[model samples]
Target: MRVGCPKEIKNHEYRVGLTPGAVREYVAHGHEVLIESAAGAGIGADDSAYIAAGARIVGSAKEIFEKSDMVVKVKEPQPQEWAQLREGQILYTYLHLAPDPEQTNGLLASGVTAIAYETVTDDRGGLPLLAPMSEVAGRLAIQAGATALQKANGGRGILLGGVPGAIPAKVAIIGGGVVGLHAAKMAVGLGADVTIIDRSLPRLRQLDDIFNGRVHTRYSTIGDLEEEVFAADLVIGAVLIPGAAAPKLVSREMLSGMKKGAVIVDVAIDQGGCFETSHATTHSEPTYEVDGIIHYCVANMPGAVPITSAHALNNATLQHGLALADRGLRAIAEDKHLRNGLNVHKGRITNHAVADALGHEVHAPENLLYVA
Candidate 1:
């Protein structure tokens, strides 16, 4: 199989879909690898390194997209890239289609087999491919929120970890999943007073045990979240609904009750955000004020640290990627977990969550592909 990778073109996106090390693995597996020139520049891997790993360096993204049987990418295809897709070609990347009807339409029109990394499940029912980036995004949320809280950055001028005789900032994380857990780790480590709210009592108990009473955990309720949001200095929106649109936990009216100059880092912004006022921001201009509350809603927070995130992502994706490269649709037919990754195949939505979110009927991949 011929696998190709193109450089990410999103705003301030520096992660390459295929690393030099990852290319070497593909090469070792007897797969031909093509990488567009400077595709690895974000992670400091140049053309020479790819060449050293036995990957042919292509001159342009156009060539990579046009020639490769399977296109591996870090972000979803942009508008121009979408037009280049064709029937029978495979697109392996993060496709947050629940929120973006345009992208979903583009994939359908292109007749491409699109497998979304974010929706891929493990045997344990965990989203394996999305975990690495989630971990990165979670950790970055606190860092970005802390910076946004500085007075010059349009925040409340409060130090996250207050000094002696000064009260520490209150952080309310609206999920107890991977993102919320890591965000709490960073927030608590920085000496902030942290509270995590979630709908799952079992998960809340797990979080409480993990934190060992260092941070607060609350059962999610309308009143519970509102009370926490109103009292918090920094709010991290970390909720997720798998491939579906994220539930908006905080409304615009609720923002009026929040502390003035407080910061909100919506880690769920890629899935359409858990905050009513949230809009996808770029690292170039990461924050904006809504009702005097600072919002840091960078959609690609992991893209800010490509070196760490790219390697981490590649680590999680390599095995499944190799399975696809080796057997293509047969791998999806054989592995239920990998089949869950199939969002679109041959002009149809195959993932139930994505289909329901986009108001389309689900076409199970098993029906779409012949089982070997």
Candidate 2:
């Protein structure tokens, strides 16, 4: 199988799909790997590194895309790259289709076999591929929110970890999953009072056990979230719905009630945001003010730290890539877990969640592919 690694082209995106080590692994398995020039430069892996690992360096993304049977990427394809996709080509990437109708339509039109990394599940029902980036984004959520809280950034001028005789900031995290857990851990480490809300009591109980009373957990209702928002110094919207649009838990009215200078870092912005006022921002211009609240809604939060993000992501995704490459889609079509990653195959929406989100009929990949 011929695999291509293209440099991420989204605005402010610097994470590459594959690393030199990943290339070496594929080459060791007798698969041909083509890396576009400078693809790994963001992660500090030069073309020479990939060449040293037995990868062929290509001149352009067009060459990589056109030549490879499978294309691995960190983000969804942009408009220009979408045109390069051909029927029967395999795209393995973080395709957050629920949030973008344009991307969904483009992939449907291209007839590529799209396997979304974010939707792939492990045996325990956790999103395997999405977890790594979520961990990165969750940690960065606090960092960004704290920075935005500085008076220079139009915040309340209060420190996250207040000095003696000064009150510490109140952080309300809206979800108890990976993102919220990491955010709470960071906030609590910084001595800020942290509260995390979720719909799962069992999960909340687990959080309680893990944090040992260091972090507060609450059952999230609109009223509960509204009250928390009003009192919060930093509000981190970390809600996720797995291959679907994030539920808008924080409404515009809720934002108006939030304290002035409160910073909101919506970690789920890539899934269409849990905050009503949230819009995708770039790392270059990461924040905007709405109703006296600061919003840090950078869609690709991990991209801000490409070196760490790329390596972490590749660690999680490489084995799956190899599985898909070695076994081909026919074998994957037989595995229920891998089939769940299939978003679009042969111009049809193969994932029910994506189909429902886009108002299209779902085609089971098993039905689309012939059994050996």
Best by TM-score: 1
Q: How accurate is candidate 1 locally (lDDT)?
A: 0.94
Specify the highest-lDDT model's number.
1
Per-residue C-alpha lDDT of model 2 across residues 244-292, encoded as one tens digit per residue: 8888888898777888999999999988998989999999899999999
lDDT of candidate 1 over 240-332, digit per residue (tens): 999999998899999999999999999999899999999999999999998999999998999999999999999999999999999988998
Alpha-carbon lDDT, every model: 0.94, 0.91
TM-scores of the candidates in the order shown: 0.99, 0.98
**TM-score (C-alpha, index-matched) for candidate 1:** 0.99
